[model samples]
Target chain A: MGLKKISDNTYEIFEEGMNVPARIFASKKILESVEKDRTIEQIKNVAKLPGILKYALALPDAHQGYGFPIGGVAAFDMDKGIISPGGVGYDINCSVRLLKTNLKKEDILKKQKEVVEELYRKIPSGVGRGSRLQITRKELNNILEGGAKYIVEKMKMGKTEDYLHMEEEGCMEDADSKKVSERAMNRGIGQLGTIGAGNHFLEVQYVDEIFDEKVAKSFGIKKGQVTIMIHCGSRGLGHQVASDYIQMMEKEYGFQNLPDRELINAPIKSRLGKDYYSAMCAAANFAFANKQIITHWVREELVRIFPKVKIDVVYDVCHNIAKFEEQIIDGKKRKICIHRKGATRAFGPGRKEIPEAYRKIGQPVIIPGSMGTASYLLVGTKKSEEISFGSTVHGAGRVASRSEALREIKGEDIKKEMNEEGIEVKAGSWKSLAEEAPEAYKDIDEVARVVDELGISKKVARLKPLVVIKG
Target chain B: MKFKFLEHTADVKFQAFGKNEEEVFENSADALKEAICDKKKIKAAEKKDITVEGGDYESLLYKFLEEIIYLLEAEDFLISKVKEIKIKNFRLKAVLSGDKASDYNFNNEVKAVTYNEMFVKKIKNEWVAQVVLDV
Candidate 1:
């Protein structure tokens, strides 16, 4: 791959087989770490997708993944484009939600232990934990189609403000349950409201520092204020949808000469592609509802542990999912299918798609840290249009494999270290906890800084964990 | 049956080896169950019929392992033993038996079977299957 440095935080990949060049938003250190993996080649392969427009860009947290690299972003012309299941990832609509509490860090520290325990009890975690809500098959179908709006409007789980803060208002339009497979539906049964294992978590943190005070204030975050973040996705339902469609697409459009079989895709206008879009939306909806239900449980637990703690949702955004978005391409606004594999849309201020309340300040970009690191809250910048297709880093991307982490780090030692640092932890399994050790991931602050330096996303506030619940 | 877990950044990966294709398929099914929970602790107290089809050796193995994941996720049915298995052309038939998820001690969760680095081939006259499961 021919590489050229466009700026201090931007690099362009001009390779032989690429349809378009790939731009990476990372500093030299971040680039060095990624070069140790196959993420660079994966980004180059993503550039070869049909009708891939602009640049197949990777964020600062980029890491090696199956077809498309994690933290990879690309846009394709609606008609000329193709939709790949690998582009959306196995965990459809895996996202992050940040909640703001009226209390300060001092208030949380006093009740951290009790609050963490209550939360673990209220919200089931771990493998195959049954739903707390007894939803019938009919209601479950509605949720599969309705998303977060179904939980809020129909089930009365949340208020209008709660729905407003979400990426798609908790429901994705054009979600056809018929497109969802029975096997996928079967996997979803009794699996709602769970924070499944492997890198998913619920963290209680405080705004430890403010970089952009004005933007932080606009987002209802302040230095020393308490906040909570939920990191998870659609669970088995989403994975099944991806698996089902990957097989379907491979059968329909045989991948005889693709870079990888995992990169199998269908033309966006094809029947199979349309069916996949519908099913993917359905799974994304489940993710929204999953977070909403957990929010309800968190609020209930918070009130019991610390009275008068008013928790308000700051923002919720999906990191893994593809959406048909209209973006300015070659001076004309065009609808393009934006595939954000392990990336998040960083639509800058004035984008009508974002919540009106924060449209002036730009969409809130939530980048979670590893198990015991500093997470960041940033806002999209207008310059993103010229960069990563208005997409940014998802989280502290992993550099170490789970097996390596399990062999090198012990769960008990991590737990003890976090305790010493005044952070509480509850995990489903020690092995899983070890796999999620902070050392397994890249430095999140350094990752976020690259995009911030590039002016794609500007840092607002930094958060340090007080309590972490890993499933 | 012989199986060894591999390394993946995002998911659980493993490879199963056997003397022949059927043995490899059965061993991979065992590998999938092992990914979910400790195989030694599970009991084969029940039985259910299983059948699947694929175009080739890779797809056949892919679908076979996928069936095991579907059983665990959808029906909450765990597989402790493979009572029988037969492969003819591109079709595979088998019987799996186990108890409900709630009845046993389970460890990790495997969301779905992914095609990343998935393949089945006879290398050195020994059938081997590799898979990376989304966990």
Candidate 2:
């Protein structure tokens, strides 16, 4: 049967195979577009998973992934639910952190090239760039155990305020370094603070418009004010862990006659599940520490270039990662594991988990757009908790494949276009740049409109890129 | 090109074809090496023997590509070619030759090899394997 429209911004499918209804949170335009893609099929597959709570929901940026859609969110019963490596993805805690700078766009317009070049040098980019700072295995383990605190509290590379603005305060207590395998550790040790390739980037932007004055002010964002956004994650370590667990889960669960092998999962209460959970947390912790170190390097680069500029991070939000939380399900408050793949946790105001500073306003949800597009800074709302499981879109999801992009768009041409638009572009190669061309992505403005209309997130400010450093 | 790199919306996908199963595996390694850097610039300065056993041909291919990825990320080894590959009952052994990544320029940082839509089957007279690597 064809999917039914729940609202102007919501649609649902109740097919025979689905254990629960699958929902899509997008406007009429996005819903129609997604129908033509593989997103709906993936969402239906997720709905058929065992013990899923409510519905399998996809955000406006939803796209077909290995198992779950990229912008997918699914909450499962703590006791009856299952945990899969595909839910968390390869790059655990792949997130974006935005820093507010005292400088204005006018101040950095002419110096964009110099600043980007310095940042390009200061922070390593591309594949195999290696770790910017060499840390012994002991220190890496401490990072895995301590999260961002290893950089801020112990190493003194950043301030406590940085940790406060991060989701989960940059430390996940469930992290057990012992659960992390030797291969994962070996892959992780030398890749910290380096931005890996394939859609990962570091962009310098400025607040182009303020939609909500109070919320923007609370976020320390002002019109024309400059900011830096780091997009990265646990890199090699997280990937290794995911690879290790996918094999383990399939072995334990017996992947006989599954819809997809990538959808292999284990019951959350199983030993394999517990081991994967701890290992995932440890890798997530590494991501937090990884971003912290990159922040340190970013700060240093800005200081070296613009000596008087002071930048403070507004918020850091992870798009990937699963978390344990309590939610009202079937009229009962039940603990559940929410797996947000290519989706962000958007806890509205008054949620106890939100930082005290943002408790009155809402949790900051940073949604970075594709290259040369307008990004958005938003906040969670009560409506989000009522509808979505406190989750929102991560970015303007890719609409075109890399091969199609290369065939249609040329890197040098797009780079020149960005330059004409007053955006400084830096990358390992121009060929890589074409694959991430702005044309390859969906209309972020349309995605923003859907979320704003759905009340899952409310827009506070919009950012336009000034300098982009692609990995 | 022994292998053609297909485009997924998000990740890097490839299909390698060979007359035999062993050549398909070798071509897959070549595709992975080309993903990292310009394979022509890479020298066969180092050689390592590798053995992998999987539940099936699909698992064997996944494990084999995963091992190649692990070597690149952990040991900084860039594979230029695979030789003397013997495949029997889902157990495969081969010798990989390449140089240290530090000695050459890097093009892409491939994170993990995934089994999503992955297959190893005979199409007509050729053996073809489709893969997707998460970067």
RMSD to native for every prediction? 1.4, 1.4
lDDT of 1 by residue, A348-457 (tens): 99999889889998999999999989999999877886567788889989988888998999999999999999999999878878989999999988887877888888
Lowest summed lDDT over 10 consecutive residues: which window, candidate 2 chain A? A28-37
TM-score of each: 0.98, 0.98
Interface RMSD values for all candidates: 1.5, 1.2
Predicted complex 2: CAPRI docking category = medium
lDDT of 2 by residue, A1-471 (tens): 588988788899989878899999888778766776678888888898888999999999998788888999999987899998898899999999989999999888978879888989888888778886889989888899899977899998899999888988898989999989999999999998888888888999999999999999998888999988989999999999999999888877877756778888888888998889999999999998988999999888888878898878789898889889887776787789999999998888898888889999889999999988889999998878878988899999988887789899999999999999999999988768998998888899999988998899999999999999998
Q: What fraction of correct interface contacts does each candidate retain?
A: 0.63, 0.69
User: Which segments of model 2 are wrong by more than 4 Å?
Assistant: B38-40
Alpha-carbon DockQ of candidate 2: 0.73
lDDT of 2 by residue, B1-135 (tens): 599988687778999999999999999988888776744567889998999999889989999999999998899988888967999999999999888877776667788898888999999999999998886
DockQ of each: 0.68, 0.73
Least well predicted 10-residue stretch by lDDT in candidate 2 chain B: B33-42
